[model samples]
Structures are given as structure tokens and as C-alpha cells.
Target: MDTTRSARIILVPGFWLGAWAWDEVAAILREQGRDVTALTLPGLEPEHPARGEVSLEDHVGAIEAAIGAGEGPVLLVAHSGAAIPATVALDRNIDRIPRTVWVDTAPVVDGSAMDASFEGDEMPLDALWEEELGQGSMRDLTDEQLAQFRRRAVPEPAGAVRDRPSLTDDRRLDVPATIVCTAYSADDYRSYAEQGASFLAGVLEHRALTMIDLPTGHWPMWSKPAELAAIIADEADAAAR
Candidate 1:
């Protein structure tokens, strides 16, 4: 158990993303002297033959491996669909992680999949930012940024989406969570937790919920990298104390 108290951020991308998605945020965090590791989930490899065979447990094991690589208190940052596997990982190793940051997503008890239509085998980048993601989700992306996103976007494995999560330990809820509320305010997130919204019900009663209002679209690292990094750095600082 490498619990040295310093902070490390292991970023987990949401559907149809890879470690490259966190380049900007990772760079910023690096400047602040925080260790950052962005993960590309198993089966997310470009044309991986095992993609169809990947399961929620595989995803969880992948995240767990990333956390084990770090040397201190780790912060697992999960974006959108990645939250499910991250939550499951925490359930098994909550002591190693001090905080979990969810970007535009939270843990759910049922761990249902988002059936975003995959063109052929993978979800198209345009379909995600243009249709699936809310309008203006990519409004902050520059032409170059958009182009780079298209070039780097990898197909998310269908199995991971459809695979059911298995979390038997309730201790996962004891780990503090910080949700970077994009397109929604801290008040809005709290209200959802209060009302027991389907997406937020599982971790509504978490030991502590540190809500930060970013007010961007789903992909804040693309739209507001600096702000997003600052929020993550703040959380890391808090965790260190």
C-alpha cells in the first residue's frame, strides 16, 4: 500500500476516449508537481480483437492496475461512463484512493449501459460531440482541437457498455467523491442527489461530496482544460491535507 500522502491523478476517459483525452489537463497537473497517469482501457485499442469479449470486470481490473502503479494517495478521475468501473475499483481498494472525481457523471447502483449507437463497431466522434452530447458540448473546442479529437478518438468496446457492474462492498461509498459538474451547478448536483436521481442514487450517501461548478459541457478537459485542471489540483491539495 503505497500511501505516502502526496496526490496522484489516474484519469479514466468516458465512452469513445483514450488517455490522449487528458493531455491538456495532465500537462497542467504536471506543472503543479502532481503525478498524473491517463489510462486507455483494455479493449479500447484501435481494432482490438478482444474488444467484444471485454467485460466490466476487465475494465475494473484495468483501473485498479493504474491505481496500483501510483506511489501515494490516488485520485481516480472518471468521465461519464468510466465512472461505473471506477466505482467498482474503489469498492475493492478504497483505502488507496483518497478521492474520486466524476466529470459529468456519477456512480449508479444499477450500473446500466448507455446505448449510444456505434457505427459499425465503434461510436463515431461526430455522433458523440454532435448528437449524443448536448448541444454546445463542443462549443469550446477549436478547429484544431476538433480535428485532433477526430484523429485520436478510438472506438469504445461494446462489451464494456453492455457489461453489468458487480459491486458487493458498500465501503466504496466511504471514499470521498468530487463531481466536476459541467452543464450543471453544484446546487443542481446536490438537488439531484437529494431527489435521488437515477444516476446519482448509488453514491448519494457518500461520506462526502465535494461539488465544483464548472458549467461547461460533457468534455471539460477539451473545452476548459485550465479550469478543469485547477479544480482537480484543488481537490488533490485538499486530499493531501
Candidate 2:
């Protein structure tokens, strides 16, 4: 690994969010001279006409295209639901991705969808917030932050949330991974992996795995942007090495 070589960092936002969600963190990374690209996965754009038709594969292809356009290997940073397609995209483009940082999420196993119970053409942000407000994932967010989030949030396409990710290459297991623990402790996540948690079935299988303790809500990029950027930069440096 060449520690001096800088790799492009691709940031993938979670459900109901676009690349704009990463503005703060991306700005900090840029200040440190790191290349970063924040993505607005299919269907998450405001008033996208064909949003309802966007599938999981569409998100995967978007990630793949980003990696393909970059030079050398890239570092992927996936938040929440974005982890699903990002994991599949990383599997498909294994050679181009040297590492991935899963923020408050884990790389799901093959054939597993982000939410099997999700129904309808889209999941509105209002409905999601109503259900998730009391959840730990929403902790630490201020009233203003929550209000802004709701104002900017878009409806997530059902197919993107419901479709199962296809990971054919076992070599994806060889890629390095870092799990930034938020809304849960690192120990708790390790225990989940030990107990074979369905969503984290692929976590313990990674050849090189690192656990980071970033105690906050699920949206660390908003609540802890500077800390998140530091972690991402450290991992990006590690990936280069």
C-alpha cells in the first residue's frame, strides 16, 4: 500500500437524502486536500420524474460509474440505507475499491434487501420520521436540524429500498471495511455479528475489519461532521497505505 498516494473518496447518502447531506463533511475533507465526491443516489433527487422507477440496481450502477471514472482505487463511505447498494457496487467493482466506511450501517449479505417490509412506490419522509423519531437513530438531533431535514428530505423509491442486492464475487470479502458505530456501541455491533445478525451477516466475514466508536445518532454526518470527516480521512489514509 502506498501511503503517499491519495485515493478519491465517494460519499453515498442514505434514504431520503441527496449529496447535499454531505456538504459539511465534504467541505472539511476538501480543506484537508482530499478528493471527495458526494452522490445523490437515484430517486432521492427533489421531484425526479422517474424516481418511483429507480431500482436498487440503479443506485448500484451510479456507484459503479463513480468508481469507474476515478483513478486508481477509491474509498467508499456509505450511510444508512446507502450501504445496501454500495456494498453490491463494491462487490461488482472490487478491484477499484480498496476500502469502505459504513456509517451506522453494515454491509448486508447477498440477496437481502434494505427493507423487505417496505411497500408502495415510495416511503415519504414524514411517515419515516413519525416512526423513527423515538428511535435511537434520531437521538442527538436538534429541533432546527430535524426541521431542516424534513424540509429537504425526499421520498425514497420503494424499489430502491425493497430490491435485494446481488453480490456475486466472494472477493468482496477481501476488501477492507470500517464500521463507524453510532446509535450503538462497537461492542454491541461485534456481539450482533457474533450472534449472526441478519443485516450484519457479512461484517465479520471481511478479511480486514476495523471498528470505530462515534457515539451519536445514525446521521453522524450532520451531528458529528468534523469527527466523521476525521475518521473518513484517517481511513482514506489507511486505504492508501
Candidate 3:
């Protein structure tokens, strides 16, 4: 835990988004003199022919490759659905990462497919996501920002979303995890974990599970990049200790 050691920060964006979604946050973190790389999951490009071919395993491999690129353990920052592959990478090799910061999402348990019942190779931006992420996070954005976001937003591949993640190692639970609560409060998330919500059961019970309160909608990176970057930097420093 050398505080002065240069550490790599891998930024993972959720569905319907590419590396561009993390532009603002990555820029702020870079200004802090930390190494940062935002990943674009395979098959997420606009009009990708392999959209239906991309599976959970493929996403896991992409994240794994990124983690392997660094010389030492990197701090992973996962937003929304990207948590799926990040968890897979951690579960497969926790030593590759010092810790993970989950943004507005909980770890997806093994053998569970996120939005499993969903069909189609690509799903359009619907009302629920519109309310939770798109429009709901507009309080801090200008008309131009919202318009650009909508224009750049792409359809998420169903294969990756519907495919189930596999975790063979329990050591992933030993890896440090911190949840940045935005769409909900720390108290609300605690209650859910206390009630043994399936997705959070293993993660919430981790010895290093930390919940940081950041009141806002699901897409805090878009609405509160400065605040989000500050929180993530603080968490990374703490993890290095």
C-alpha cells in the first residue's frame, strides 16, 4: 500500500455506452496525476455486426485483458451494467486488482443472467432507462450535453446482457469492494443487503465492503463528474493503504 506508487485506474462504462461515457471522469482523474484508461466493451460499437455474438464470457475476456495490461493491480471503476464483467474479472483473479468501486450497481451473482428474459440483439433506450439514467441525470447537464448524450447513446447488445456470468472462485468475495450509492441511499442499500438480496448477499458481507453516499440518479458520471472523480480518488487512495 504505497501511497506514492503510480496506480492504473480502469474505467468501465455500462450498457449503451462506450469509452466516451467516461471521458469527463477520466479527464478529472488524469489531472490528479493518476494513470487512467476507459475501456469500450467488444461489440458495443454503433451498428456492430457482432452484437449478437458477444457473450458474457467475451466481455469478461475484454476486462481481463485490460487488467493484464498493467504491471500491478489496478483499481477498477465499474458503472451500472459494466459491473457484470468487472465482477467476472475479479472473481477469476482478485490479485490483479486491489479493489473495485461499483457505481450505482451491485455485483451480479454467478449463474445469473442480467436481464435474462430480454430478447433481441439490441434494445433501444426505453422509458425506464430514460427516467433513471438519461433524463433523470439531466439536473447537472445543459441542453447541449443532454442532446449529445442522446445522440451518442447506442443500443446495448442482448448477448452480453442476457448471458450469465460464471464465478468459480469464492476469493472474489475477499477482494475489496466499495459501492458508490447514487440512485439510492446507503441506508436503502444496507437494508436491501440486510434482507439478503441475492445479488448483494456475497458482496455486502465482504470484510472490505464500503458504501459511499452520493445522492443523485444512476448516471452520476454524466451529471457529477467532479464529485464522482473526487470520491473515486479518495477510495483509491484508501485502498492503496
User: What tens digits encode model 1's per-residue C-alpha lDDT throughout 25-139?
Assistant: 9998887677889998987777778666677688899999988885778878899889888888888887888777899888656545554333244455665655743566666
Q: Candidate 3, residues 1-241: lDDT per residue as tens digits?
A: 3445745788889888899999999998888887788988888778678677778788888888888887766888899888888888888877778788999887767876777888887765653456655446455566787678778887777877788788888777777788998877889888887887766654564667888888877778977889999988876776566
Candidate 2 Cα deviation (angstroms), residue 4: 7.0
Q: Write down the lDDT that model 2 would get.
A: 0.88
TM-score versus the correct structure, for each prediction: 0.86, 0.95, 0.90
| Cα displacement (Å) at residue 21, model 2 | 0.6
lDDT value, residue 81 of candidate 2: 87
The backbone clash count of each candidate, in order, is 0, 0, 0
Candidate 3 residue 185 Cα shift, in angstroms, is 0.4
Comparing candidate 1 with candidate 3, which one achieves the higher lDDT?
3
| lDDT of every predicted structure (CA atoms) | 0.77, 0.88, 0.79
Tens digit per residue, CA lDDT, model 2, 1-241: 3434767899999999999999999999998888899999888889799776899989989998888886877999999889899999988888788888999998888898878788789988898676788776888888998989999999999988889887889888878899999988989998998997878877777777788999999899999999999999888987776
Instruction: State which candidate has the highest TM-score.
Output: 2
* True lDDT of residue 122, candidate 3: 74
